[model samples]
Target: MSMKLLAGSLIAAALTLAWGSPGLAGPARPLLLAQASQSAEDIFWQSVQNSTDPAMFQAYLDQVANGTFKGVYKPLAEIKLRALGKTAAPATPAPETTAQDRTTPPPATEPATPPPTQTAQDAASSPDIEACDRAAAHAMDDQKPANLPGVTFDKLDTSAAITACLRATKLADAPSREFFQLGRSYDKAGNYKEAMVAYKAAMEKGHKRAIYNVATGLMKTQRGVKKDPAAALALMERAVDEKVMFALSGLGDYYRLGVGGRRNYPKAIDYYNQAIAAGDSQGYVGLAIMTYDGTGIPRNRNKACDLWQKGSSLGDSNAADYSKRYCRYR
Candidate 1:
């Protein structure tokens, strides 16, 4: 887990269940973070012992932004790290200016690589590809509910936020999570090549989340990446070890499809169960499909119907469509 993530979870855990109660205008919210602690144990105690206050942690994070840990506080921001772009890194680092920060800007330029089986032109024109891309982008949209927890458009003020993000990550003392954030920024800007650089750097620094994300990007054939199921599966497994639910679902998909490995229906079922235990909706849909097909497990229409109903309730469109075909409306 990233230190930034640990910090946020720790702070939220510090909240008084009875928030907005008397004496909580601001000051009485949380303050132990006002003073940095000596040890990791104390740090946890200090964080959880205080009230829920993002500002306190934000200030604490700012002060330690360039500290030894390279801690960053963003949660679920890295995404869409496509492999369809430039082959070369920039000659120099971007200036510490806010304006150049990552945003949903226009495509700066396309890489010079020759068109593949599926060119950008083709992808743009193909309704299926366009819809898939839209779904991907929509998942990361900060504006509405994707029904995916721990994900949000936390950096709405792109310029200032990216400035802070870059400044923090640029410090020789900065954490790998900072680079993960940088990759997310670049990904948001549609700079897939640059995003990959940041992801690689984060992975080098042992960021499991970055490994997970790079793996997902590699698996997206529509993203112009050469398929590397084995490599992607390996990375997802690593992230799953860190107890990331996203990685668990990824493993389920990889196992079911035999991507980067042999088709193991049983393993896929297990991974999907793990994700479902972690409250991920994707698991319900995956498990439902496999049960319906009877690929690995016995075909049980009743069980599959029940799973599809659960998944559809969780907002999985595929499960909803499948329900219409194979099972009566729930």
Candidate 2:
């Protein structure tokens, strides 16, 4: 299926529950309200118990937003959001900054020679590199969600990760994925120059996420790399074609922020929605910021709150902060 059609189907599937009827009525209102109140309490505590999983918190917000229950748990939800990431901002900015300080890309360099693929047989013959993978794995890795725990860029322990990844890279059975993780470690550690080298190495081995990282470097014009928004956007388009989920959101940001020297609100919204459909919660955060600011979209504080609430539920701290700061429920 095409990306757009696929996105539409996925979006429809995601909203299936959201669009369902609550089944409240005059005769059953009292009993239903009591049931809903209990359900809300149960869900809120459940989210608190599994605070590590943002989806739990999102469930509670979903209930409240959909009118299944009163928003009594909102305050506690805000607390959870704060604990998960940075403190809430005092006020909303006009345009949310797309520049990620921790994961900024470095200059492109000579590509590393591709190593032999680490097949299952090779891995079985060598010492397990699970420790290195655990230390350096990134949340944005398209291949990691099912096999490993992914850490956010800001949350990474760069020192430990870098050491593990460096050791992993020296192994004869090391694969392209290790180099990508090593680049992520360096980027998070603010060693963009080294990060670029590792990313190029990963790229030479056909690591798709490395392409996104290189494109980001070109977009941000930091890390000793010359600015090339056009090149960055082109690379992102290619990454999207290669099924890199992060590239979907990255494209949304580019159009949203005029990174390519021209803002395209319609294109931005399309990309953001597509990203959200693809299960990238950052898409919700970007769209919510645009909604809050009324930039190329109708200004709807409530809609923005709903968007942030969804993004927060998906483990985005920035989304949680925005929802906390702006999603005031009466």
Candidate 3:
């Protein structure tokens, strides 16, 4: 049959179902079915002309009846009968099952447990945590370059590593072994800037080695703050106060070379005596040179030769060479 004739038949059936007998109706039912029929006709004709899939077209019709056509039309029951298809009755729903007859119980659920909280004391007492705190303390205590013991640099990168170590140590409230390591590292790296900082930090923390290192680094590089000879002299003096043998030797050299602002041969001699008293042979060699050169003191070649012999006996190589060439009397 033509789509128009089929649509007219479906509309007639819908109106009959909506109005019941039509002989005795209080008010005619709303023209819902008539409108729904017109909509359904438009969709069906468009789908057919467009060659839509038969299954999809049927599903579309079913959705229209259940959704947009819902409330406005008689239930799917009368609508299905009126639709252009072979008639079939709606299927009945199965009976509900009882609780006892249910197949399985839902899986058992565990009660949620909150995580334990740590007290401050408990946290402090934790072994792992205590170790970290101790390590940090050590690093802060040893942050100075000069105070570090047994520092041997294998390469420039080793020095860079030391700088990094010192930087890490500086963040702590006290000097640590790590700080000393850092200072040594920078010194090895030839990064005198960071090395001086690390040594000063160590010195401030009461590290004797760092005090000496600060003096030496400052003297060597003439950097980190102003290049003050007076300051270097003061630092070397402080190192002497600590009774460090190498610092005494360094002080003697500084005086002998007229560094740290002034030339004083007598002062140099005094410093060299201090170094010699501390069992440094190099001090003897310096004293011998001053006598040999007649620098600031009266010329005394014989006295110089005698001092060189004494220095050679203490394993000073320069003294040995001078004695071999000039101290035949010895």
lDDT of 3 by residue, 188-282 (tens): 64546556766677677677767767776666444333455667778988989987656777788788886787777888889888888888776
Better of 2 and 3 by lDDT: 2
lDDT of each: 0.59, 0.71, 0.57
Candidate 2 ranges beyond 4 A from true positions: 1-125, 139-147
| Model 3 residue 179 CA deviation in Å | 2.5
Off by over 4 Å in 1: 1-164, 220-225, 312-330
- TM-score winner among the candidates? 2
How do the residues 1-330 of candidate 2 rate in per-residue lDDT, one tens digit apiece?
Answer: 432343334334333333333455423223344334334344335325334434445555555687754765554454445444433223344575466844778778999999777675575234435656788776667655357778777788876776567666766647777888889987886666568878879888888989888889887756435688998888888889988876888899999988866999999999999999999888998999899999999998889999999999988888899899888671
Candidate achieving the largest lDDT: 2
Sort all candidates by TM-score, best to worst. Answer: 2, 1, 3
Clashes of 3: 14
- Give per-residue CA lDDT, model 1, range 160-275, as digits (tens): 33444544454444455556666666576554655676778978987667787788777755322456777888888888887655688889999999888789988999999998
Model 3, runs deviating above 4 Å: 1-177, 220-226, 298-330
Rank the candidate models, highest lDDT first.
2, 1, 3
Please give the distance, in angstroms, between residue 27's alpha carbon in candidate 1 and its true position after superposition. Answer: 75
C-alpha-based local distance difference test score of model 1: 0.59
